[model samples]
Structures are given as structure tokens and as C-alpha cells.
Target: PLQLSQHRVREKEAVKQSGVKTAKVKGVKNLEEIKKAIDEIGYPSILKTCSGGYDGKGQWKLLEEKDVKSINWNENVEYILEEMIRFDKEVSCLVVRGINRDIVSYPIGENSHKKGILNKTIVPARVSKDILEKVEKTSQEIRKRLD
Candidate 1:
């Protein structure tokens, strides 16, 4: 659980194992690796610390070649270069598992972010029923995998 919560790369790997689609990602240990990952992932990508970052901190958006030069790269810290995906809306599902291993999922929620911070979340996200069901199933799958 700590591994999943603290490491973005590990978390994304878990998500992928659960059959959820995720942005293309590659882990890097230094600036040279980051440049190589950017070349592979292409422009409009995001660089994020592998661990210990919250809210909007420890992230940089490399929209173009010039944007890469603006980052204050730290060679010691591990990072992940992820393909930036543009989406219509952001939604989430909360799933909880009891001590006895019983699992339950709440209704899907629509999330709105402001300046990289979560501003609001509306319950019963304004999405189709099929999409909501899929999200819930995916959430449960992720929770199960975490166990």
C-alpha cells in the first residue's frame, strides 16, 4: 500500500495490470534519460517525480522542446515521463474494502481541478450509465490488486 501511494510509477503499473488504460509512461533517473523518454513519448508530455509529490508540486509540463530547458532538473530524483492526455472531463470512483475482504464502491464522481489542485467533486458524475459502471468496476479491480 505504501509503495502504491508513494510511487507514481508503481501505481501506474498496478493500474495497467488491472486492465485500465493509462498514458504512455517511462521512468527516468536523470536529465539524459528524460530527454530520451521525451523523444519516445513525443511533445506535450509531463514529467513527474516517482515519489513524494502532492497537489501540483514536483511536476513539469514539456509542451515543446523549449519547455524542457525551463525545468530545474534534479539528477538524484527519479522521474516518469508520461504522455499528456487531453480529456473532456475527469471522473473518479471510490472503492473501499473491509477487514473481512468485503468490497463496495460508491457512485462515480466528476472532479474539477483548479490550478492543479482539486477544486470540487460532484457525486453521480454527469456521465453515461455505462461509463459509470465501467469506472466502478475498474476502481474495484484496482482496490483488489492493491491487496
Candidate 2:
């Protein structure tokens, strides 16, 4: 659980292996690797620390070739370059598992972010029933894989 929570690359790999769709991501260790990944993934992508970053603290958006030069790369810290995903709304579902292996999920919530910080969440997200079911199912799948 700790590993899955801390390592973004590992978590994404596990989710991908679990048959969940995710944005294209590449793990990079330095500027050179980041450049290579950018070439492969293309522009308008994001660079984020692999661990210990919260509330959008360790993130950089490379909107174009010139944007890459603006980041102060740290060779010592690992990073993940991800293709930027555009979406209309952001929703999240929380799943809890008990010691006896019983699992339950809360209703999906619509999330709003301000300057990359989570602002508020509205429970019972205003989404189609089909989308809600899919989100719950995806959350369950992730929980199973992480467990």
C-alpha cells in the first residue's frame, strides 16, 4: 500500500496492468531522459516527481519545446513525464477495505481544482449513471490490484 501510494510510476503500471486506461507516461531520471520522453510522448505534457509531491508542488507543464528549458531539473530526483489529458470534469471515488477483506466504495464526487490545488468536492457527482458506474468499477479494480 505504501509503495503504491508513494510511487507514481509503479501505481500507473499496476493500474495499466489491471486493464484501466491511463495517460501515456514515461519514467525519467534526468534532463536527457526527459527530453527523450518528450520526443516520444510529444508536447503539452507534464513532468512530476515520482514521490513525495503533494498539492501540485512538484509539477511542471511543458507546453512546447521552449517550455522544457524553463524547468530546473534535479538529477537526483526521479520524475515521470505524462501526456497531458484534457477533460471536462474531474471526479474521484474512494474505496475502503476492512481487515476481513470486505470492501466498500463511497459515491463518486466531482472535484474542482484551483491553481492545481484541490478546492472542493461535491458528493454524488453530477454525471451520467453510466459514467458513475464505470468510475465505481474502475475504483474497485484499482483497489483489488493495490491490495
Name the 10 consecutive residues with the lowest summed lDDT in model 1.
Answer: 138-147
Can you write out model 2's per-residue Cα lDDT over 28-135, one digit (the tens) per residue?
998889889998999899999999887778998889988888988888899999999999999999999889988889889999998888899999999999999999
Q: After superposition, how far is residue 6 of candidate 1 from its true place, in Å?
A: 1.4
Query: Which ten contiguous residues of candidate 2 have the minimum total lDDT?
Result: 52-61
The number of the candidate with the highest TM-score is 2
| lDDT tens readout by residue for model 1, 9-66 | 9889988997888999999988788889988999899889999777767988889988
Off by over 4 Å in 1: none
70: Cα error in model 2, Å = 1.0
What does candidate 2 score on TM?
0.96
Q: Local distance difference test, per candidate?
A: 0.86, 0.91
Candidate 1 TM-score to native: 0.92
**Using lDDT as the measure, which candidate wins?**
2
